[model samples]
Target: MEQVTTVGIDLAKRVFALHGADGAGRAVLRRTLRRDQVMEAVAALPPCVIGMEAGSGAHEWARRFRTLGHTPKLMAAKFVAPYRRNGKNDGNDAEAICEAVSRPGMRFVPIKSLEQQALLSLHRVRQGFIAERTGTINRLRGLLTEFGVVLPLRSVIVRRDASKAAEALPGLARRAIDDLLAHLRVLDERIAAYDRELEAQARGCEPAQRLMKIRGVGTLSALAIVATVGDARDFKSGRQFAAWLGLTPRQHSSGGKSRLGHITKRGDAYLRCLLVQGARSVLHTATRHADRMSRWVQGVETRRGYHRALVAIASKNARIAWALLSRNEELRIE
Candidate 1:
């Protein structure tokens, strides 16, 4: 129970590996503790910086460790990857975590609060329901074609066609179509319910409120930002934040020369997707407006086509979002 300076924990389901280094950089403690004994074991030691990978149960353990007077840091797995030397095992990974956290230039993940996690959970559930509904619609469309019925392009039209087809269907096909429709209805209801829940949650958050001032951002984008970026202060700049969300063009450099390429697309896929989809809505509905971003997008569309413009606008939107986030104010889009 000496004064430890840095502690690296490799967490697992039933067992945990702890590697502790003393103030003098000596390997003073190495032990395997049961899941139940983890807190008790750490609590006995003096307060120190505890580094753990952003894995399952890490946040709960982080809260627990912080309560026990230790500073907890969540390290991204990718950041720790370079520290791995030779074979990768629990002990090696624990050592790598130690090495990674000890470095001065390592970036850390901000721990999300319960409310933020709740918002994210709602979005995930809604996404699943939407995917399910889409599958049901496609299946319905495919099945109707077998009976010489061609569905129209629109989803609503397909839905209506499916309903009418079900009514005129034979015994087995009717039952199958009925079951699919029922599931689709249930999914739609679930998605709507979650949207309401998220909207309510977003209303109370200041960052989300500020985000809604932008043209493209709505309840979903606002809530997604609150859920995804837990603390805006953790980011250095709006550009950095935007890049972190995969909203910036990537670069390729060699021999002191640099060339920019497509977006890196290396961070949270969900938030990036939400931002892009929100931007698409803007393109579809508000591109006629005389705003700078909208005008830029229109120009790109005239030259490169629609999707390319969409991505460019989405990246710009993310940058604007980061600016709004860092300043903690409503957007002043012009």
Candidate 2:
């Protein structure tokens, strides 16, 4: 006991490791608890700062701990790794988390609300469906090619010609092709349904609606950003927000010489992908519109070439999104 002031728990499925420190940062408690005993154990202790890595079940635990009068700090696993000493066991990990959470400059992850997690669930499932559909399409193409029926790379063309090509194949091969095409059709329907649901959600969400007004930010991109980034204000600046999404360049500096490389591509790969795709959309149609953003995009395209222009627009859009979400401001087309 010794009046615990801070604690860290290494989370797991069945067993957990706990480390506790007193006011003077001296280790006062170290133990393990089973899954069912965790809540009761923590409830017995006085309210204190609890820290854990941002991973599976971390948010739920954080939410629950808040109700028990405990302050929960969730840190990225990598940040906690350096603090760990000796072997990689639950006890050492918990101890490291205890040490890391007390650091004044250490960053913490924002706890996600149930509503936000729910919307993100939809995104994850929809992405899975899309990936499955892509694999199915590729399989269909590969199967057809083996039977001397060459189809173009386009899905639309495959949909049109697949049936005719299948009709000319041998009996079992034809049946197999038919089945895959049917499966593809089912996946398409499911994906479309998810798209409609997301569109409705975006329509109802004020933040998402505002985000959609930004060029190249469609329903999916807006919703993804909103759901993934719980509170934009957690970021000190738009540049920081962009850096969090791994849209900013990585640095390799030493001896006071500055060196910048490609994007670190470190955080939230899905969100980064969505923003980059939106940037590509902006780049393709920049010539059609005379708006300031379009003009700037065109200039970047000309000066930096296509690929760098994409990153420029993506990073810029990320910054604008941060401003919109954090400051509650409207987009100004100037």
Task: Provide TM-scores for the models.
Answer: 0.91, 0.96
Q: How accurate is candidate 2 locally (lDDT)?
A: 0.92
lDDT of 2 at 320: 91
Task: Please identify model 1 stretches exceeding 4 Å from their true place.
Answer: 145-153, 167-169, 285-287, 299-305
- Number of the top lDDT candidate: 2
**lDDT of each residue in 8-69, candidate 2, tens digit only:** 99999999999999999999999899999999999988999999999999999999999999
CA shift of 93, model 2, Å:
1.2
Question: How accurate locally is residue 83 in candidate 2, as Cα lDDT from 0 to 100?
Answer: 97
* Residues 1-334, model 1: lDDT tens digits: 5668898999999988898888777777788889999989999888898999999888888988998899999888998989888688888788788778888888887888877777788888888888888888889888888987889768899767787877877989989888888888888888889878888887788888888887678888888887778778788887777788877878898999999888788778888887788878878865568877667777888897887777777777777777878777777756
- The C-alpha RMSD of each candidate to the native structure, in angstroms, is 2.3, 1.3
Residue 20 deviation, candidate 2, in Å? 1.2
TM-score between candidate 1 and the true structure: 0.91
Superposition error at 243 for model 1 (Å): 1.4
For candidate 2, the per-residue lDDT at 69 reads: 97
